[model samples]
Target: MQNDLFYQELDQFNLFSEFAEPQHYQPVPNDWFVVITDVVNSTQAIQDGRYRQVNALGVASIVAIMNSIKPLKVPYIFGGDGASVCVPSSVLQQVKQALQATVILAKQQFSLEIRAGVVPVSDIRQLGKDIRVAKFQPKDHFSQAMFDGNGLSAADSLIKQANSQYLIEPVESDSLDNNDLFEGFECRWNEIPSRSKEHIALLVQALPNEQFSSDQIYQIVLMAINGCYGDELAYHPITPKQMSLSSKVADLQNEAKIRSGFVGKLTKYKYIAKLKLLRHVGNYLMKNKVKTDATEWGGYKQRLVENTDFQKFDDMLRMVISGNEEQRVQLENKLKQLQQSGLLAYGIHSAPSALITCMVNDYNHDHVHFLDTTRGGYAMAAKQLKSQLATLKSVE
Candidate 1:
């Protein structure tokens, strides 16, 4: 059977406002598979000051699967502690091996447990759920994938179940030949401090009900958010002026560890040293606005900010915004009204700064920045959201 080009052939919509509209999305092909990867005990890891590691693992999952299936563009979403990707059946086994390799790499290098799984889209539909996806291009240089419908949520739930049939357990291996598997995965940027009083990492999930659809509820929430913080990009969590390359050994070593993947001391050191030098050179180029043949250093930061996935949707609305107390309060008050009205459940985690993880295949173009708050961004908000969901379930 020929692999479906559903995602590759789909048209992209430009406006973020249109993301909540149901008409913009199409159902994921039933023959394709949903691949998910998540860090176990991530909330505890974040509390232990390991959010950077958590973010890297999430991006690592995407990088590995993407590199393995090169030239075949698919839809994916990067959560702070994990990631989800939809792939054609043609590469299911290949993709699963990459995921297993990623699982091995995570445990060996980071001492982190990654739960990886694959489920057929047909199964999700069999259970009366669906995965609909759309392409969102906030900037011409980058296209962010957006997911609606409960199919992804169902996949996550299924994968997390104990002894579930879908789980992918890594074979016992001391090391994987993974130096080339995680290409283009980089995390050299220093955390971006909030331009306003605080950075809010928020998640809003609409409830299922007969009165109104999830799309209608999300549209109201988006409008309320815009009302609190104007439609301009000023409220963006990461700004060009606030962005700078990190020189920290710890930051450099995170990428080195993933790319090196349980290699000998000499190889690991070489990886770290190479990254250190790259960081130094990047600092020089960007600080002096040196334009190279590959990238326009002067405009790269602006483009990075424009392309950051600070706001996205995948069955739920996820965002990282910089706003003052007044704006935060206004937004929360509006959210409170929505919750009281039984329209949606929400959670927000406020922090001093936001974190940026990059998957850059090219310096000129082809890069997407993943955003999260420094301490327990999406993971923490998700915890709170889960509690609220329970409360709503009880009342329902």
Candidate 2:
């Protein structure tokens, strides 16, 4: 498989409206493979107040893959608890190897179970599923691929199949040598507080129907959401008031996973001390007015604001928002109406803080971060909606 050939084909695609009709999507080639990565027991971890770690592990899985296949853009989507991405058949083996190490890295370094697997496009097509590609160039600095087919959703379900041979497993020994696959991956940002002092993590999927299409249902629901709370900026979960860097060693110790030996304790303290220094560095750079100051901290901070992944589509509608009590009530009221009308399935969770996860391949640019409601909010909501849909099926 000529990997460069994959990008050449991808470049021919023009930007498309995210809200366009679903059937208009272009089918992905049968030669490509879909890769899925997710955290096992993420809900329990979030309940233990480790949602930040869960979010970071989710981002780290993609960072490891992208860093290994640098200069070659692949189609990927970020789910709050995990992710789904598509890569050419040529790079299949390398992608799996990197993920094997990532599985180990997340377990050893973060005590988290990061499940991963790859399924072929041909296999999914045989199941009567499909995948389509669309490019979203949010800014010159960043671009993302939006998937709108059942193939990815199908692949995700199969990868998570119990005891499936395709799922990547932990190595027998602790010396699998992750080879720093996740180098430069950072989750140092604090949980951003809502400016409105209220937040809602939202997830929805239009129930498949012959009477109305998923796209139509989604547009109606999205319009209702925006009409009530506002667009990304008006009810943005992370505000300047919420953007603060944390030096809390408690979270850092668990993430870095300092060795248990005496030397390991010293190394742990060293990392903690380093974070303290980094905090001061952040404060100094943020306060500096001149361009030639400590660093271009001002520009980077602005970029974080610009790059927030507030809402995205991956065969489903997902969002995280900060809204006032009045706005939340209105949004939920409309959601109830939709439920009664049977156009969509929805789930929601709220918390005091909005979680942010970073993907930094380039310091100056070409990097982005994702935001989700605290504690695997989207994942939790998806589970609830699935349960409701199941009940609906049994009754029918």
Candidate 3:
């Protein structure tokens, strides 16, 4: 019966593969915009030794504000200190209103100062490339500003300058050569920190992906919580001997703040919570024999379909045991298909069974893979679609 189910999954995998060739070029819309918020004088706050209280209050405030705005359907990102949000243009005014309200609330409630900025996305493809580049070149001015400097404050000024120079002009066609865009922008901002260059790259990339039209004023915000700036630099334990005295002090302050930060508080507790949840879910699914979420199931299937790495499949077998019978059957079917597709190499089958038993017995496998397989599959699909769209750019 398992073999039959597995073969059935293999058949489905083959079907998915037939349509997988063009998974690289998904059309990302251009209506998305970014809102950058930072805390003013964060470095000074850390130096003053109020980093812990400030971060806790700041993150809590942000979370509270975000929860209030959840009805608006805007997705947001929370970086330890501050946050960046991407909102569709249709809701731009609403987002601005919410931000403004939050700023006012921060002042009244926490005595924290807040500042925010927004940038409309035009090409996501370019943005992804730019992010990659920026990640690789961290020493540049923009990177420094983002990481430690006052670049967030200056981002609006730079955007305004770019607008004056016609740098914000829309592309004449929907299709654009990402390489050309990267090179042109890089040359245009050669004097700027490589970080800024990468920032521009991300903007360009977000443009195509979000299908942005017309110039939009990017909103920037700075938030100071518990009498300290929330957006400050991350600190490393190791300090270089040649570092300046001022730099060393700054790093020490940040390290101290992190020790007492919200992340520090949540780390151990959250880790345990996740392990328990995954194990419970994994066992439930296995016993009941139903499929887990389609998004997750489809994602695992895609890895095999695309012939990509299969290590991603390891997580599902962990917490997947607790799903209903229907879910278990679905998972079993999916796994069988993977093995039949020649994707499962060594011990995937045994792993799931062992994982199920471990979950039932409450053993000590605490490793919970956090990557959402379902989301990964969608991303893969989107990339394929984007690649197809890139072809259209060449024709244009």
Candidate 4:
């Protein structure tokens, strides 16, 4: 397909039904580029209680790139500690420059080192790998790119293997004017608590080709849990009680409050107050139906409740869920049953609270969040899970 037709066709591609299948996704255009960004010492920072910064940086990278390349739709994912974005070749140079600025912001503002790069999808294919993606809407205006095959992993590995010329290198800079790209990134709410005040950040992988399709095993696993834990919403961590705004005025830094000038500091204060007021209004709307110019605000809350980001899949099915110790045990036991059947590999990290990082483009619309446990963080948890899967490799 021509580039223009390809872009238009991808916007309409839809074949998967009920559950997304790995095979249904088509290869991304070879001319497009995959830009991967992650905090270099995110695991340590999360341990230092700077989990919010890690999450904010991941979302910030996305906001920066998207804002720079408006009128273009990019496919991306917020991976707890970082993000992966695939942009069309047309904005390749612009996206790289935007990401470079973000790397500088992450370091200067949050004191976090971020690694980012623009990698050509064609180069990945040249390495005998391919990029296949299916777009799925966990929520409207919050579209996620679902990956398949080995290419996504190949591109990611190349990006992180070593700093290359294509990397979005951070420049030494004292200026903080354009650092406001993270305008919507917020961590105002305190860590969400489970009813039992205990939560688990989980990573699960279907044992590759163990006499079963990976997608089949995934469905069975989810069905087993839905059977045990009740409906999907029941296991969602964002209960009405756990949802509230943090009133700390100092938390605005990760929201990308610009501070290059005295005027900027004053502007930050005003935005902080606006955020607090919006939080109160959001809390009220969550409980009570209120009419609005667009639609009822309460319905939006219901939509958020129903469209929780508790579980996600890339090459692995990963989750950060809120529940009691008992609930954790119940899910683990089922997973063990699946494991014994040579169907999957699983790892769990227990935490007291689940952290949320939000990207709020509009008050009433275009809001999405990335959720992860603060303890070991999802990146570390996923590493452990992948190691287990390698040991339990099921070619049997």
Best by the TM-score measure: 1
CA lDDT of 165 in candidate 4?
Answer: 62
Model 2 segments beyond 4 Å from truth? 1-17, 172-179, 254-269, 289-295
Q: Per-residue lDDT tens digits of candidate 2, residues 1-396? A: 564455335543233235446543566778888889999898888888877777777877787787677667887878887888888877777788778777876776677888898888888989998888766666766666667767887898898788886787655444423445565566677777778867788877787579877877887887898899877679767765568777887655533442221134565577677767877887787767325533366677777776767776777777788887788889988987888788877888777778787776665576687888776677777788788788778878
lDDT of 1 at 268: 74
Model 4: clashing residue pairs?
Answer: none
> Across residues 24-89, which tens digit of lDDT does each residue of candidate 4 receive?
577888788888888887878977877777777787788878777765766777787888778887
Better of 1 and 3 by TM-score: 1
Best by lDDT: 1
**Of 1 and 2, the candidate ranking higher by lDDT:** 1
TM-score for predicted model 1 compared with the true structure: 0.96
lDDT of candidate 3 over 1-396, digit per residue (tens): 132121112211122111212221122135555555544454455446444323433343334333334434333322323454444565556455545544543354345665555664453233342110001112121000011111222333334443332122222221222112111000000011111111000011112124321111011101111012121121010111111111123222322222222234354245344444544564454345445434232222212112211111100111111122343244345433433333221111111110000000011111111111111121222233345346545755
Candidate 1 lDDT, 57-167, residue by residue in tens: 999999999998897899999989999999999988879878988998888888999999999999999999999999998777889899987899899999988899999
**How do these models rank on TM-score, best leading?**
1, 2, 4, 3
User: Candidate 3, residue 345: CA error in Å?
Assistant: 37
Candidate 1 deviant stretches above 4 angstroms: 1-3, 174-176
Query: lDDT value for candidate 4?
Result: 0.70
Backbone collisions counted per model: 0, 0, 82, 0
- Alpha carbon lDDT at 391, candidate 4: 71
**Candidate 2 clash pair list:** none
Candidates' lDDT values, in order? 0.88, 0.73, 0.27, 0.70
List of clashing residue pairs for candidate 1: none
* Runs with alpha carbons beyond 4 Å of true place in candidate 3: 1-28, 57-65, 68-74, 123-396
